[model samples]
Target chain A: MNAVFQVNNLNKSFGGLTVANGISLSMEQGDRVALIGPNGAGKTTFINLVTGHMPPDSGSVALRGADITRLGPTARVRKGLVRSFQVTRLFSDMTPAEHVALAVLQRTGRSGRVFGNFGAMPDVMAEVSEGLKALGIDHIANHKVSEIAYGQQRLLEIALALALKPNVLLLDEPAAGVPQSDTSRIEEALAGLPDDLAVLMIDHDMDLVFRFARRVVVLAAGTIIFDGTPQDVAKDARVREAYLGNYANARSSV
Target chain B: MAIQRAIAAEGKVDAGPNWLLRDLMGLAAVLAVAGIGYLLFPNNLALLTRITAIALLVLSLDLVTGYCGIATLGHAALFGSGAYAAGIAAVHFDITDPFAMAAVGAVGGAAAGLLAGAIMLRGRGLAQLVLSIAIVYLFHETANKASNWTGGSDGLAGISPDPVFGIFGFDLWGRTAYVFGIAILAVVFVLLRLLVRSPFGMLCRGIREDPVRVSAMGASVNGTLLRMYAISGAVAGLGGALNAISTQVVGLDSLSFTTSAEALVMLVVGGTGSLFGALVGTLTFMWFEDFVSAINPFHWLTIIGALLIAVVLFAPNGLYGTATQLLHRVWNKR
Candidate 1:
């Protein structure tokens, strides 16, 4: 399989503390991958650096074999690498449909249009439908994002990235805010995604990480401890020690 | 496509009127009302004319402070520059045409916006506020020191704007001035209405709401903000030019911190995020200022300060914002 995304010798430091240290990984097209780590293991920071939310101290990220180290998030998104926020990053005032419509608008290569009469735009409704349907949110397209339930809002954020019609989707801790019962719902949505969309998700939930991801990459102390199949990662002594260490207390509280 | 209808069944249109038409109809209504108002009270026509000019000024402020979310207190500098440019052109260069005054106004405002935008881009929030205050004081002192051209502390006069379009000569009551001001205001409102609702406007709001996200989106969010500042300046400058032409005088008051503060209060009172809010705020404030002054001498400053504080604390959204929310609540109740 051809590699869709490649990260090389990534390192980032915030003040005196190192966040991502010499991290190297790759994602194959159609690969369902989980980036698992204990809290503060630099999973989110690594994702942020790849998506250009923050820059790596020294490293390179490539999408479709082309370098995107200096590209901004939107430009990176345009080139088919998009990531969702850990906390829902949505236009709260805007409806679910409007949120999707704006994403669709960006994908259309339209110039920045903060002030046009977008009401008359012909494809707006269609774009909203495509996005909402992807996440089974067609029923709440017109609802204000703020008015939606917490689980639904999380779904809406995923729908927003899906609306971008992205080739590669990066979901940062999708299951973080979801309740136990609703987690199954999120799992179902992840399971139902077509093979065409390659999703690189970061999760603290070991079950979803193991169940959904065909491949799992484990990080501990800002370094990749293991990158292999779920069974292989589960068997790895290093990953087990990282989680079975002080994380035993951390894991039980959740 | 059918899925969209299904989605629509879930939620209704939550926004107010469609943007472009709302502005056109709103401004047209303002002009019509002003015409009727000035016609009825010919004596107060001059004050009403000044109010219309203030409405325009507030509209410009809304662009910078409200929409773009840029805190600007030095806009008074741009307004003062426009007033000075128009006054000098008329008093010294023998160019008294209203059109010439408008051109000079636009250029003066654009220049301030460009200079200020370039510098302010490096500084946000309190830094911007400090820089803006400095600019205001700098211009005020410059105008105060330039005695010959600006008339120094006295202010430059002899504006003598020849009856707009060379028709219906300038009367003592300033009827012709009010009409011309209202007409130009109509045009400005329409142009601005279109510009603000455009994609560029949305981008501005996107940046205003979350600059970090905007920067990530591959757009130079700061660059876009800088452009917005320039546009705000040009529009505000034109508004000041109108004041100079209608009054036939340019005062150093244009550069005062009081002028900047008043503009802010007007924006908040009128509802900052929109054009009509600016109009309504200015009109209401002018009425209160003029009429209240008749009953008590120090009504304008005292009431405006109190009103601003009340609006900020109680209303939060100000007049138009509160009105919109109230309407939404009512609609939901029904």
Candidate 2:
């Protein structure tokens, strides 16, 4: 099977510290891959390198077999490789509808329209409403992003990434700061996403990782130590010692 | 059942183009002010005309600093470039047609904007602020040194623009200039109102809030901001051209730092983000200056400073922004 995304020999270093060390990975279409690791395992840096947020020291990234390593973040996004932020980067003064509408407008190549009222643009508004509804934030579409709860903003973060119509999505901790009670909503939103889209979610919540991901990749000391099915990840000794030991023991104790 | 009902209701409720109504009202208010100015200050039409020209400058400044969130104190560089361009075109080229001169001024201003935006965007926050100030000083010195073309410190003279469409001469009564200024202001205002409500405007607003997020959404933030600066320069150039045509001269003061600083103060006083706020701030500040200086001549600046401080404290969004918020609250209650 052809891979939709391929990373070959990516290397990134800050000073002498290697954040991404000769890492290589690949994802097929419709893959639900969870990247889990202990803190400072270079998961975020790897995501950054893949998404073109920063230039990797050495490596090449390919989307659909076309080289995209040198492309900027915006260019990568236009090529259908979109990412959500660990911290929701939303306009505080604008409403959720405006944020979603902006993404939809950019997706349709109409964000440059300077004459008509964007609110009056039918396609943009429809997408905005639909995107918001999908994230369960439709009721607060008119409210400013600042007025929404932190959990809602986190969901809006996912909603914005989805609005770009990404073929491959990189979600950087979608439920990072969300209260436990509110995480189910994020899960529901993720669960409802299209089946054909590839998603790589980096979340510290193991429950979310295990429940949502069919395949798991474990990063340890800037390298992938484990890559297999979620069931196999639980059984793998390296994954337990490196990252999943706490979750495995907790499950047994419970 | 409740969810279904809400969804059905949402479908029926159109967010419709409410801005069209706001635009019409804003135009009416502007025209009404012009009419009032004609009646009350027939003798002071020059000052009123000057206010109109400065209003355009402040409005243009709002586009870059307010909408695009590009901090600039060298905006007067664009204005000065336009003014000098129109003055030179009228003097050396004998291009006396007001419209043609305005067009020349616009081109000059846009060129200055493009150059300045490229240089200034390399820095952020404090560095950007310093760069903008440096650019303004550079423009000022260039205008001063190039005495032959720009008339140097002595100022450019002999700008004799023809009548409006060959029908009305720019008479001593200032009727033609006043009417011309108001008409141009109205057209520009309407265009800008439409622009700020458009997708491009929303993108600028997004850039203002967070450039990183805007880029992540597939926009080139620097390119968008550069385009915004050029458009702003064009608008300011039109204003500068109007100044040359109406005043019949261009002075070094056009490129001065004071002009840039005053424009920023006016924008802050009016409310930075809203076009109406720019106009309101210009009117309030200029009128206050004209009226108070006429009365107190020496201590007027102290009064103006006090007023600015009061505005910052009491009406944080400037006069129009604060007033609208108050009105909205009252209307909601009703």
Best by DockQ: 2
| Chain B TM-score for candidate 2 | 0.95
Total clashing residue pairs per candidate?
15, 0
lDDT tens readout by residue for model 2, B142-181:
9999999988999999889999899889888888888888
Model 2 — interface RMS deviation?
Answer: 4.2
lDDT value for model 1: 0.79
List ranges where model 1 is wrong by over 4 Å: A14-16, A72-74, A192-194, A248-254, B1-25, B89-95, B145-151, B298-314
What's the TM-score of each model vs. the native? 0.90, 0.95
**Model 2 global lDDT (CA atoms, 0 to 1):** 0.89
lDDT, candidate 2, at A55: 95
lDDT of each: 0.79, 0.89
DockQ for all candidate structures vs. native: 0.42, 0.52
Error of 2 at A92 (Å): 1.2
